[model samples]
Target chain A: MAKGIISWIDRRFPLTAIIKHELTEYPTPRNLSYWWNFGFLAGFVLVLQILTGIFLAMHYKPDASMAFDSLQTIMRDVNYGWLLRYLHSTGASAFFIVIYVHMARTLYYGSYRAPRELLWWTGQVLLLSIMASAFMGYLLPWGQMSYWGAGVITNLFGATPFIGEAVVLWLRGDFAVGDATLTRFFALHYLFPFLVAGMVVIHLVSLHTVKSSNPSGINLEDKDNIPFHPYYTSKDGFGLGVYLIIFCWFVFFAPNTFIEAVNNNPANPLVTPPHIVPEWYFLPFYAILRSIPDLLGGVVAMVMSLLLFAVLPFADRSTIPGGARYRPIYRVTFFLFIADIFVLGYLGAQAPTGYVVPMGQVATFLYFATFFILPIVSKREDKWLRARLPQELLAQFDRTNALAKGQNKGDAP
Target chain B: MSDSKSMDKPLDCPERRNFLEKATAVVGGVGVAGASWPFINSMNPSADVLENAISEVDLKVIEVGQSQTVSWEGKPVFVVHRTPAQIAAMQASKGGPDPQEDTARTQQPEWLVVVGLCTHLGCVPTRDNEGWLCPCHGSRYDNSGRILHGPAPANLPVPPYKIVSSETIIIGVA
Candidate 1:
């Protein structure tokens, strides 16, 4: 009887086949590490954000006058509103954490090379779209930080020529940040997640198109592959367990760790805060913005800093397909680049006066130089590597068969 | 490489076919534009949005030299009952930066009204003895809200206001 019903449904839709193809029977590389599970963790965070955000939106009032009070009401009055709000808020910070790790893993593994270029670009767009959604969502509370933060960001557009003033007025819907801005931001906040969800779909679609890149950075044969159902699905389940432990720690114990104390105060336009910094995730880009004294130039530099990731596939001229894993020189440069961003991010939170400005400029210079000069350095290094160890490259490119790799003399280790 | 199909219709030249294709595209474009009109129009200010679109301020209780701020459409509207000296000083001043007479800025000689934002970067300016001083970049506006000095390129904008009675004025409506 169950078989008959299953066949009836299967005739209409290839449910069993789809499950086998996409989930239960999907082939994945055998040597994937703990880092690979972050893709699933990011997806989990997205779902968490959407779920908590939907509930919070049901109670959120977008008026600047009432938004602050509404947040209090949600905390003090609504049933489980505090839980939903914290989940959504902390989920935002958690979202960035997972995504940053995911992107860094992509860079470290050279997943953006050649065939996965489109996949990587889609991810870059997804990152940008998610960043925009998070930025807009931050204003829903109508806190002092939210008000001035939104103002400074919108004011950045005033650097554009000709229709700058008109565009600014149109965005704010008033001469200054007020109810209209709040309402519009709320509407966009409600709208952007769905847009991001669409981008996520595209991102996943592009990812599935090329299949996943592995840490080994080599194409695995059927023998080196495992069905995703019993293997990766179990690994992913375990990863989710660890993620939830960390997530629940924040949700239960340290809910307000990522939130600022000043954000408790209502938005007041008459008084500008002592320091106007964006959320921690945006600090590096914010540093880039303040690094240049010229307004338009600053805007351009900040934009280029983000969009430079798109040029990564073309920028890499290395023959080492094993990514930074095998390339020692590139690996050192990669770590230095990460350190530079951390320094820039720290400088961004500080007042942009005195030594901070010059230091940020130096960091920013190094950040850009990382992408532009990597290809040149890799090309030169490839020559020396070819001279000393030409056999390594040949062995890496032409592995006879995965099952027979144990017998391969070059890979004796 | 030429096909025999072209020989059958000598009048159907490349230009004629191109014109037909272009004309069809233009018509389709117009149809799409027409279809999009309602969605575009719906985004304009609806009735609910227009609720806080105008604000009425009571002017009777405000005495001379006293200023009061009221929120209209989420912007601070400054209503100052000008002192005789300030009004006289404003009228005597021809043009410092923004080329506008005092009469043009005020509905009544005793009452001064303007949006309380700096023209330079949209910071709210603080009122002073002479006029208003922008705390951000130090742009100054005269009693008539004319740009007096600093980085401001234009005068503090006078919002469109309707004085229905001597005791009350409505802002944000022509």
Candidate 2:
């Protein structure tokens, strides 16, 4: 009966063929390290987020009048409601952490380079969809942070000339972030996860088309390729186990780790918090946003920070795809870039005043300077690295050739 | 293999083919748009949410020269009990920025009520020593909610409201 159903379904759809092609028989480079596990972990967290979100929605009230009360009810009244809410909320943070690491991994490996630009772009699209979804979802609680955070963000659009007021009104659906904003945000919040899921499909499809770029940033032949089923399936299963343990550790122990204390109170438009900070994931960009003094210029600077990633493929003019591990200078700059972002994030959490302003401005400047200067720096750095790095490539090449000759078959060399 | 049906020209007549193509496109476009209407409509506040939108507040609790912020239809409605001197200052003002009369913003001379949000953006303006100051921007309002200074192009809007009793007021359903 199982065989008959499988055959029937296989005849109608390419179900088995697709599974075999993309999952079981798919060839993945054997040299993928633990860093590659983040992609699967991100995918895992996305699923978890959607599942928890769906359950939370079943009990959630999107109206500004009841949104905070609804969240309270979910926590206090519903069956394991607190668990689901915490899971979803924590899952959002975890998803960002995983995705950021995944992006960093790709950057370090030069995975955004040639023939994989679409894959990188699709990943960016996925990132944007999730970011939008997260932003909209943040408003559903209708807490002080939800109201004021959204107020600050939407007002940023008011910097636009001519139709700025019209745009702000249209986005809010009224004069302010009140009933209309909450209701619309809820609807869009529900809609965007499905959009993210769809984008994930496109992302994965594009990823499989070009395959993956390994740490060495070099293409590996069939000899270096391993089947997905026994090799990666088992590997990913173990990675997921470790990921879940860490994830559930947060979910069970410190569920409110990510939720702000100000959010516990219902939204009071009159009483602004001393500091209106967004979720930690958005802090870096928020820092950049506040770094500029001009309203329109600040908005532009913040937007450019996000859009800078999109142009990385063209700007970072280097043939070395995964050469960061070998290139000492790029390696140091990459870590420094990471450090700069962390500093910006720290600045974002603080009020934009006094010495924090200057520090944030410098950090923000360095953040963009990393991207703008990477191509020029990498051009010089690549030559220096390559002159010293010929032996590493040769060794990798010899290993691939030996694997092709069946000298290193079915073993971890 | 050589049937007349197969031999017949795919676009038998260009006019009919064009009409058919255009008609299909239009029908498909209308169908898609029609399907999207409900999703768009659902985004607005439901009748149930709007049912309890109106809010009533007791004015007895508010003293002279004091302001109270109340939620009406899930937005902050600022109710200020203006002192005689404060009211005079507002009325005596040689208008600043986008000017509006104090009487227009209030139904009673002493009782001033307007949405607390800044006219420039939706941020709630903080009650200041004078009247109100928008923390997000420098937009200021007098005791009567008139835009006094800054980038605000308009005054704080007064929501539909009415005095229901000697000490009670209802906002939103006026």
Candidate 3:
């Protein structure tokens, strides 16, 4: 019987216990919003990307000479290869969309606050890993954009103080972006997703340790919590159904939405396209890089923009509960930051020209300003809002704070 | 309880034990790094890539006022047989972004050789009447391959070359 097998494994390993504890009976906030669905959706996309990527790799050649041709062959000759490729490409974009929403949800809900810092950091690491994987995968097709984009990004290392040139050369495995670079990128692209999957496990572990933060932004009591199996499993399943409909539409109908037209042509280093743009996901950071006049300064600024996420827990030193749930000013600030990011992404797609330069400068300033503004606003808002809070809510807040303070003694709130 | 308490106590040579532990960890760390070096260094330019370092160009075939594109280590090398007017125009103006004299950018004023890729983002600049214009970004380069104006932080790089004979020039060898 299934029970006999499970018990046999459970005696040696914590298999049944793990499933029961971590999946079926795990405590989760009952008031979790649709935004909570994105984490599950991100995990789903990760698996989708891995599966589609494995299938595509079977027919794809990594050599610079044959890379483009191999892709064509996959499209023309291999059965369901186009579907696999499209799904993988579409899944890459979907993964980013899901992660961004998940992160936005985190920021809005103050899920990155104390006791969940490791979870946020793990998510950040996952983002970096996925970005690296996507960058490497972009070069696999050996298209003009792939070649030039890789050249441009790899050249960013050339902005380093001393060992810049050497690092660039080492990265390319040649004087220029060539066969060695393509092969190596292919190898790493295949590698990074597995590493990401491993990190995803860590991310989950961190998440479960602190438990999920709800939109209400309060640590709900045991009575307010619900078991994961029937509640969240069903909810996540419904979210997955919705996500798949959108994903499959892109994969089948608008497969090339994420892919570039210039990427169709084989990589010719001798000719640069009229305009070389990065994939849509990288546009905001690309805009930030272009905003700075100096190469080294731009590279540093771009890198800092990403690293700024890691410091959010420390930066917003507000004792405010319910992140943006009650804070009107903070909500507006959050929306403005999101809009600024959109503007930056749009600007990044355009050529750096007359008005674009000035506009980009303004947007870049706003992008960085949001982070600097957050702490001051959060602290002041906390003071302003605390006076107006109901006595019961204030007492609940105090109790939660006490629990957070006492967490070092290995007690869960 | 007594036996367990005694077991928890320090050994006779605790310092030596600690030293052994530290030494083993250090050795293991070094071993891991040593094992990783080959895989890490394998990504560096290999022998076959290094072998194709030099590219020989037949300068005799290229006519005056004409720019010939030749492959050098898989990068486009622009060999422009600069006209007298072109050389004069380049020598007269100071390059923007990176201020360099025309003479510094070329081995000979009449025979200008530089990597064809744009200094901004490695896009090949198309030849123009006045200079080269990078289509990707709008980086302009003078006839001598010095950056005129635009986002390119530096001039089109001048690859190392030796003028072996009147007919041939060897690129990638000084």
**Which whole-number lDDT from 0 to 100 does residue A167 have in model 2?**
75
Give me candidate 2's interface root-mean-square deviation.
4.0
Considering DockQ, which of the candidate structures 1 and 2 is the better prediction for this target? 2
Model 2 lDDT per residue over B42-123, tens place? 5545575466578898999999988899987566889998899988888787457777777777788899989887766467
Local accuracy of candidate 1 as per-residue lDDT tens digits, A1-413: 99999889999999889888887878888889999999899988988898988898888888877899999999999999999999999999999999999989998888887677788898888889889889888988988888878887887788789988767766777667777778988888888888888988888877665678888777677799888889998999999999999989999999999898889988987655555678999999989887786667878999999999998887877766757887788788789988998999999888755698789899999999998898898888767666777786557654522322343233566
Segments of candidate 3 deviating more than 4 angstroms:
B1-31
Clashes of each: 0, 0, 0
lDDT-superior candidate, 2 or 3:
3
Best by lDDT: 3
DockQ of candidate 2 (2 decimals): 0.22
Q: Roughly what TM-score does model 2 have, to 2 decimal places?
A: 0.79
**Chain A TM-score values for every predicted structure, listed in order:** 0.94, 0.93, 0.98
- Per-candidate iRMS values, in order, are 4.1, 4.0, 1.1
Clashing residue pairs in candidate 1, if any?
A: none
The residue-by-residue lDDT of candidate 2 on A100-155, one tens digit each, is 99999987877887667788898988888899999989998888888898988888
Model 3: per-residue lDDT, tens digit, A1-413? 99999889889999978988998989999999889999999988888889989889899988877889999999988998888888888888888999999989988878898778889999999999999999999999899899899999998999989999899989999989999999989989999999999999999998888899888777889999999999999999999999889888898889999989989988997888888999999999999999998889999999999999998988877776657787788888888999999999999999988899999999999999989988898888888888888888888887786676576357654
Clash count for candidate 3 is 0
- Where is the poorest 10-residue window by lDDT in model 2 chain A? A401-410
Q: Each candidate: what lDDT?
A: 0.82, 0.83, 0.89
Kindly report which residue pairs in candidate 2 clash with one another: none
